[model samples]
Target: MNDVYRIIVNHSQLISFWDFAEQPGQEAVAKGPFPYRLTEMAGPIERVEDGPFGAAAQVKLGQWWNLPRHACPELNFHGKDAKLTVLAWLKRENIPNRGCEAIAGIWNETEKKRQYCMFVNLNIWDSADQVCGHVSAVGGPTPGYKYCMTSAIGSTPIVKEEWHCVAFTYDGQYAKVYLDGVLDEREDFNPYLYDSGLFDGGDDGANFTVAAVHRSNEMGNFYTGAIGGLAVFKEALGEDELAELCKITV
Candidate 1:
């Protein structure tokens, strides 16, 4: 057993897990301690070889997965001041457009609110014209998702047809995005500027969707790529460890 993950916290610190390894031919399944499931499949998230962790899953234009609401208790954060980390192995050889390429998120799109997310930006409306990672720690239960964002710190074209480890961290103090284990962008969290609740666990009625954010009624913003070993950790990882995490087992 991995003793590193056994730290007692009144609840399982590692909440969501989907390896796409043990389960083959099946459409969706949740292999974690919590009852979290990739129960919702918009398209066909096919299983492929040479996964980032063990085995990997791939998605195309309309392909996606989702976790039913309140299934992610770790997102709530409770009284814990530790950082929240999202790490995934991505291989996007093709992109539909220069809009928003969402990796994964704790978002409730129907209400136009997102708790937190890591995405690829083409700098459409902004001056920056590079393809970069966009990380956000958003606060909501209101009109739109209010957030402090950290963006743009890597090369363009976003690495095609290759396995790259992408990560984002929210340590209560700052938000940082990592590409291939390198810290690319960093921004501080602004709480005083917003007059809403900061961390309130999450919505019980919400759902965790992968590869798809359900951006509009047509269900656009779908990520056309492959992802392996998507995991959420309660604690933020150091730079060295983040680099090490990106290393694939050969």
Candidate 2:
């Protein structure tokens, strides 16, 4: 295993980690205590030999991975004290639509079941092409806005065709976004505070989705690029821990 995989697996709070080494048309197996597998959905994604890790999933707009909510109980993080961390190693690429990109989460905007999702270029608060940590404590938009406005938006733009480590975490107080293992600080933005905690999306809530989300009555916000690795934790990781995880080399 690579250093990144080893570090994540050793963490006590780790929920799941996907290395994206599986072949095309095969299920992406997650390694951890839960080991919940993600099924390829919508369309086929290529498995390329080149990546930050050994292999990667090269995806397009229509491709994604799905894990039914009920089937993966460990990923259903909620409640007043709920904490979470999601990290991904991705080679970003520009899409034709140029809309926000969803990396992973249980966010389902159509059903108002939004919880939390790691995103890029959310195009909100005068922000674009930056790492975003979208969180919803009410499963709907913030009181005065049409869209969910609670998020920690990073300052750095995600450059295309380059591998970068992007991540976000919630510590029951603030939602923080990180780029390349460091907090890409933006005042009142990178450490967006919301103490209400995560929303419990119940039994009929959203499914865990990767590279896309169900929004506006259809699947959209597709992340087009190569995803080399992904990991989820039940607790927010510290800055040093994230820095170490980003040190992995192919």
Candidate 2 regions with alpha-carbon error over 4 angstroms: 95-97
Residue-level lDDT of model 2, residues 26-140, one tens digit each, is 8998988878989999766798877876899999777999999998988888888889999999997755547889999999999999999999989999998999999898998
Q: Which ranges in model 1 have alpha carbons more than 4 Å from their true place?
A: 1-13, 22-35, 77-82, 95-98, 122-157, 185-205
lDDT of 1 by residue, 214-244 (tens): 5555565667777876767676666787776
Task: Give the distance in Å from residue 122's predicted Cα in candidate 1 to where it truly belongs.
Answer: 5.6
Per-candidate TM vs. native?
0.73, 0.97
Q: How close to the true structure is residue 3 of candidate 2, measured as C-alpha lDDT?
A: 66
lDDT of 2 at 61: 72
TM-score, predicted candidate 2 vs. hidden true structure: 0.97
Candidate 1 residue pairs in clash (backbone atoms < 3 Å): 67-208, 69-206, 76-201, 93-161
Top candidate when judged by TM-score against the true structure: 2
lDDT of 1 at 131: 31
lDDT for position 87 in model 1 = 75
Q: Worst 10-residue stretch by lDDT in candidate 2?
A: 91-100
Give Cα-based local distance difference scores for all models: 0.56, 0.89
